[model samples]
Target: MRLMPDEHQVRSLDHQWQLGNTRGQMRTWGRGQFRWTTFDLSVERGPDGKRRIKKTTLTDTADLKNPLRDAVLAMGWSWRARLSKL
Candidate 1:
């Protein structure tokens, strides 16, 4: 599945800008109704002074049966991979 941000979504992303959440992500799926998932990314320094990416998924929902569940999950992982590159 392709995740393309629409005009409204781009506008909503302005909130992230305002909050200085440069490394966060927000994604949604579904048509008439939607399921949203968000990730917050942060960086912390360890005792060795190394930096690492910390990610947190902000949305929690029941895992109901869906025919496309596997594909959707795969897509989410692919998205995460792309994020890691950034």
Candidate 2:
């Protein structure tokens, strides 16, 4: 999947916030309006203790809201804190 140029920071398992990569496809429809849909967030941690994400071809079919809630419960962080307009 092709992701947007920018990424939004999200809290992960570590309790510290980090960038979450969004994966989706750009679609053109209805009077040339383009939109990205069915996007999902992914967060990863590197050896240096900084979080990073790598692109993956597979997209999880599960609902994102549940996982976001789980993150909040597990890490005690608000998902809305760093959310963007997208």
**Most TM-score-accurate candidate:** 1
lDDT of 1 at 86: 21
Give the per-residue lDDT of model 1 (tens digit) for 1-86: 23434411111111111232456554432222234466899999878999988889875332431334455555543222121112
Task: For residues 37-79, write the lDDT of model 2, one tens digit per residue.
Answer: 3444578888999998766545442354466656655764444
Q: Give the poorly placed runs of model 1, Cα more than 4 Å off.
A: 1-35, 61-86
In order, candidate lDDTs are 0.40, 0.42
Where does candidate 2 clash, by residue pair? none
Give the Cα error of residue 55 in candidate 1, in Å: 0.4
Model 1 misses residue 62 by how many Å? Answer: 4.1
Q: Going through the candidates in order, what is the number of backbone clashes in each?
A: 0, 0
Poorest lDDT segment (10 consecutive residues) of candidate 2: 27-36
